[model samples]
Target: MKESTGQTIMIQGEQTGILDADTVLITGNVSVPAGGTLTFLPGTTILTTGFFGINVEGTLLAEGTINSKLVFSVADTSGFYNLYDSRGGWNGINFLSTDQAGDSSIFSHCTFYYGKAFGDSINKMGGALNIRNFSKIRISDCEFKHNKAIFWGGAVFAEESDLKITNTEFSDNFCGTPGPPYGYGGAACFRYSDADLTGCRFYGNSSTGIGGAVSCEYSDVLITTGVFQDNFSGLGGALGYLRSNPDRPVSCNLFTGNSSLFFGGAISCNRANPSFINNTITENHSVSYGGGFYCNDSAAPVLINTILYGNYAPEGQQVYIWDVNSSPSFYYCNVQGDSAAFGGTGGIGFNSPYLYNTDTLPLFSGIYPSPFTLSDNSPCINAGNPDTTGLMLPETDLAGNIRIVGNVIDQGCYENQSGLTATGRVNKELQILCYPNPFRENVTFILPGEYHGNCSINITDMSGKMVFSSSSMKGNSFNWNVVTDKTTGLNPGFYCVSISAGKVNGSALILHVE
Candidate 1:
C-alpha cells in the first residue's frame, strides 16, 4: 500500500478502515478480509487498470452525497473508443459471502462505467457489480452505463442474494457473445435471488439473447415505479422471467419502445408465474409473436389494470401464448386486439369467463417517458378492478399523482388527476336527428348546433351487425341515399344509426319501407 496526500495511491492486498477524499489507483486485484470494513467518503474516485477488481469478503460502504459522487472508471483509455475496445479494461467489484445476515454492502450516489467482466468461458457473470452466495446489498441513486459483459449481466449479476436497488439508472449496457442463451441480461441478471427495484430507469440496453434490460431465473422480484425503454433482445426486450414466483409482482411500471426478434417485445415468461399490475406496455414490436407479452411452457402471468397497445406482430399483436399449458389471466386490462390476438384455447374477451379485459383504445400520450397519460374522454379512466384485497398497489402513479383519482383506480401506470368521472362524455346534451321514418328513397341525419367536427355514422341491424358505415359526414348533417346492394339489398326492416362526433356518441332508430 502506497499512500499519498494529493496524488494517486496504489492499493492492493487487504484494505480496511476509512478512505476519505482520496484518489486510489488500482493496478492489481485488491481484497478486504473477513470482519474488515472499507468505507469511502464523498468525492472519491477509484481508477482501475490491468483488469484489477476489488473483492470484498467483509463489508463495503460507499456513501456519497448528491453534489459529490464516487466514481469508478478505467485508468487507461488508450485503445478505448467503444465497448469492444474497452473490453477487459478493468474487472468489476465483487462481493462474495455465504452468510446471509452477516454480509452488508451499500452503494449510494455512485457512478460505474466502462467495466468489462469476461470471466473465462465458465463463470462469465457481472460486468460492473457481482453479488454472490447469499450476500445482502443495497444500491441507491447509482448510475451504471457503458458496461459490457461477455455473458450474463452487463452491469450487475446476483446469485442467491437479497438486493434492493432504488432510484438508479442503467443505460447503454450490453451482454452476450453473439449467440444462444449465453447472453441473459443487458443491465442485470439474477438467479435464485430476491430483488426489489424501485424508481429505477433502464434504457438503451441490448442483449443478444433473453432480457435486454433484466432477466430472472428462480428468483422473486418486485419492481415498482420503474421505467424500461428502448431495449432490444432476441426475447423479452425489457424483462424475462423463468420459474419466478407468481406472488412477486411488477407493479406501477412503464415498458415502452422495446423490440424483440422472436417473442415478447416487452416481457417474456417461460415456466414462470408473475403478476403484473398498473403497467403501461406500448409501442413494442416483436418480429414473430407477442408484441406486448409472451408466455410459453406453462408460464402463467396475471395482468391487472395494465395497458397493452400499439404493439405490432404477425400473430398475437398484444399477447401470444405458445404452449397450451400456459394460462394467463387478464383483469381490467386494456388490450389491443380481439380474443384471437390473446392466443391460447382459453376464454378471452370482456364477457369471457377468465377475463375482465377490453379491447378499448388506451390513448397514450406518446412513446416512452411520455407518462402514458389518459385523455379526458378515454375509456380507461376509472376502469379498474374494484377489489383490492391482496393486490400490491403503489401509492402514487408514475407522475407522482394519486394512484386512484376517483373512487376506483385507473388502468395503466398513469392516473389522470382531472377528476373526471367515467360517465362524463364529450357532449352529453348533444341531440341527434334522423329523418324519413318510413321511406324507401333516402334518409338524413342532423346533429345539434353545439356539435362540431367530423362525425361517423354506422347503421347496424337489430342483431348488432353493421350494414352501412359512413365517415364522410361534414358540417353536422349527412344524407344517406338507400341504394340496392349488389350482394344483398336493403329489405324492410328496423336499423340503429349510431353517430359519433368528437367525444359524444348518440344513436337513432330508422325504418325502411319496401
Candidate 2:
C-alpha cells in the first residue's frame, strides 16, 4: 500500500497505479495527459481540498470490491461545514476525450459525495463526474450523494458520450439555482449521447428547472428496472426527455412519490416519442398538469401494460397532452380515471382499442419501493394484451418474476401467480361465472346446480359502496339491472359483485359502460 500525501501531483504521458489501502491527498488538481492510464486499487481514498479535482484525457479504472470501496470527498472538515456546505469546496473528476473511439473509463463499487461544479459563464456541468466529446464510460454499483451543480447535472454530465450505468444509486443531489432552463438533471444529464441505465435508483434529488432525476436531450437511452422516488423539479419530477430518439425504450421502471411544481410529476416529454412498457407510475403530484405524464410538441409516446394511479393534478390527473400532434397511445393499461384523465386537445383516442383497459382500482399491495405489486384479487391479473410480438418488454417483471405466467400476461408491472400452481392451474374448483362482463345495462351470473339453496347477490363500486343487492333468490341464473337501490342508474365504471349461497361465498369483477 502506497501513501502519497502531496499538495499537487501531475502524471503526464505515463501509466500509474494507486495500490490498495493507499491514501492520496490532492491539494490541487491531478492531470492525466494524453497516452496515460491511471488505475486505483481497492480501499483507495482520494481526499481533496480547495478546488482540487482530476482531469483525465486518457483512461481511468477504479475497481473496488464489496468490502473495500473507493471514496472521493472533500478533505476539509473545519468548523460549521455540513454536507451541503461543502458543495463548492472541491471540483470533481473530468474526463475529456482526444479520441472518439477508444478504451473506456470504468468505475465500480465507488462512493462520491459533497463535490460541486460551479462552472463559469462558458462551461458548467457535472458536480461529481463529467464526460465530454465522445468519451466512453461505464459505472456500476456506485453511489453518488450530496453533490451540487450550479447549472446542470448535479452528479454526472455527459455530452456526445457513450455511457452505461447499472446497479447504482443517486440521492440527495441538486442542480441549478432557482431559474428556468438552467437547472437540469439533479442527478445526471445527457446531451447528444447514448446511455443505457438499468437496475438503478434515484431518490431525494432536486432541480430548479427540469428532470429532478435525469434529463435527456437529443439522446438515445434505454432504461430498465429503475426506481425513481421523491425527486422534485419544475417539470418532470423523475425524468425529462427532449428531442430524444423514439427507437429506444424505457421499460419495467417504477416512479413513485415524486413531485413537480409545474408539469409532469413523473415524466415530461417534448418532441420525443419513446416506448414505455410495463412500468408503474403512481403517487406522483404536479402543481400544474400531468401528475403521471406530460407531452407537448408532437411527442407521441407508446405505453403498453403500464399502470397510472393515485396521481394528483388539477388538469390531467393521469396524463396531459398539449396539442393534437402530441397524442400518446395507451394499450392494456390500468389508469385511475376515464377519458377525463387525458387532458387537452386529443380526447378518448389517447387510449387505443380499449379492449383491456380499466379505470377501476388496481388494488396494489404497497406503494413505497415497489409501488405496483398486484394484490391477490386484483383485477389486473391476466388482463394485459397478450399480443407482445413487436413491443419491447423485459423478460422478467419488476420483482424478477417471469413476465408471462400463463398464456396471458398481467397488466401493470407485476404478474400475479398467487392462485395458480406450478403448471398454472387452479387448485380449487371454479365457484361462479359472469358473462358479458363489460355490459351496457345488465350482466348475467351463473351458479352451479348443486347449490340449490337461497342465494344473495350484492354489487359494490370501486369505493366499496353497495350499489345493488338482492336477498333470498332461489335460482341457478340471475341478471343484474345495473341500478342502485334508490332506482338511480350506475355510472360507467368498474364494480365488484359478491354472491353468498349457503356456506359458499364468491366474488367477481364486472365493468359498466355506456
Candidate 3:
C-alpha cells in the first residue's frame, strides 16, 4: 500500500476508481463526479489536514473487514474542541442526487469522527454524512462519534432518500444552535425519507431542539431491536417524530435514562401517530411534562404490549397529552399509575376502557443492557394481543430469543426464555443461596445439596457488565472477600451472580453497601 503526504489527491489518475492505500493525507476536497464510482478498500485511512471532504455524486463503496476497519478523520486533532463554532474539522461525506447508472452505495465497518457541518444552507447539517435527493444507501457496523452539526443531524442527515442502517452505533454526537430554533437529531435527522434502522445503539447524543437521538419528519421510519440511552434534548429525549407513519412500526427496543427539558422523556410526537409495540420505556425524566410520551397537534400513538415504569414528570409520570387533538391508547401494557397517572384529556382516561391495560407491578430482571426483561413470576407473561397475525412481528425478540415463547407473546421487548434451553428443551432452575445478602466486604455462595463438585461463578453489575469470574472452584461453598481480592472490588449497587454446576444454571441478585 502507498502513503501520500500533504497531497491534494492521492489517486489523481483514477479519481473515480479504487483507493487502496495505507494512508492518504489530503489537503483539498475530493469529488467523485457524476457517472463515476469510488471504492475504498479495507484498512484504508483518509486523513484531512484542513476543512475538506469527499463529495459523491454517483456512488461510494467502502467495504472494510472486521479486522481491518476503514477510517475517515482529521490528521491533527489539536484545538479541535476549541473551535466550537461548528465550522471546525474536516467536512463530512456528502452524497448528492445521482441519476447515473450504479448500485446503491455500501459502507460497512467504518469509523467517522470529528466531522462538522457549517457554512451555507446545504452545508449546515449532517456533520459526518449527508444523503439527499432520492439516494439509496446501506450502512452497517459503522461508528459515529464526537461529531457536531450547526442545524441538524450531528452525525447523519437524510432527505428524500431510502436509507438502511444496521448494527450501527452513535455516541457523544451533538447538534444545535443557541437560538430558539435550535436543531434536530443529535445523531441523525431524516426528512421526507423512508428509513429502516435495526440493531442500532445511540448513547450520550444531545441536541437543543428535538430528538437527542433521532428526529424524523414525514418519514416512514422503522426502528427495531436497538437502545437509546442517556440522550438529552429539549423535546424528545430519545426520539422526536413529525407526521411519521410506518407500516412496520418501532418494536423490541429499550429506551432509558433519557431526559428532556420540555416534553417527552422518551418520545415526542407532533401530528405523528407511530406505532410502538413490545417496547420498554423506563427511567426517563422530563422537567416539564410527559415522562414517557408527549403528544400534540393531533398526534395519537398506539402502544401495545409495552411497559412504562419509573418515569418522572410534574403532571404525567407515564404519558401526557398537550391538546385534545392528540389521543394515545395503550393495550395490554403495564403502565405505572395507570391512565390516571397521566394528565390530559386525550390520554388514557376513565372515559375509555383500559384496553386490557394493567397496573400490575412488572417484575423485571433489572439487568443492564436489558433492564426490563420479564422475570419468571412477572404478570406480563403470555399477556400480549393474543392474536399477533397482523402485527408484523420480528422472527426473534430483542435478545435473539423466539418472539413468542409460550402460548402468547410477552408484554415487552424480551421474551421470557427462563428454564428453557436453546433447542426449546425444558430445564429446571437450580437453587443457589447467598448468605449475608447485602454485605459490605464479604459474601458466601452455597449451591444445592443434590450435587456439587466444580462450579463456575460469574458476577455482573445491573447493566450486565462482568465484574468478576471464577472457574473450577472445587466445592459447594465458596467464600469471597471483596476487600482482599483487589480485582473484585465491588461497588455499591445491585449485581447478579450466576453459578453453573453440572446441569445447574441459576442466578441470584446481591446488593453491596458502602
CA-lDDT, candidates in order: 0.78, 0.76, 0.80
TM-scores for all predictions: 0.80, 0.77, 0.80
Candidate 3 backbone clash number: 2
lDDT, candidate 1, 191-276, per-residue tens: 98888988999999888888999999999988899999999888999999988774668999999879899989999999998999
Query: What ranking emerges by TM-score with the best candidate at the front?
Result: 1, 3, 2
Cα displacement (angstroms), candidate 3, residue 489, comes to 17
Candidate 3, residue 36: the lDDT equals 83
Task: List the candidates ranked by lDDT, beginning with the highest.
Answer: 3, 1, 2
In model 2, the runs with Cα more than 4 Å from the true position are 1-15, 19-21, 77-87, 347-355, 367-371, 419-514
lDDT tens string, model 3, 195-246? 9889999999999999999999998888898899899999999999988776
lDDT winner between 2 and 3, please give it: 3
Model 1 Cα shift for residue 136 (angstroms): 2.1
In candidate 3, residue 1 scores what lDDT?
A: 24
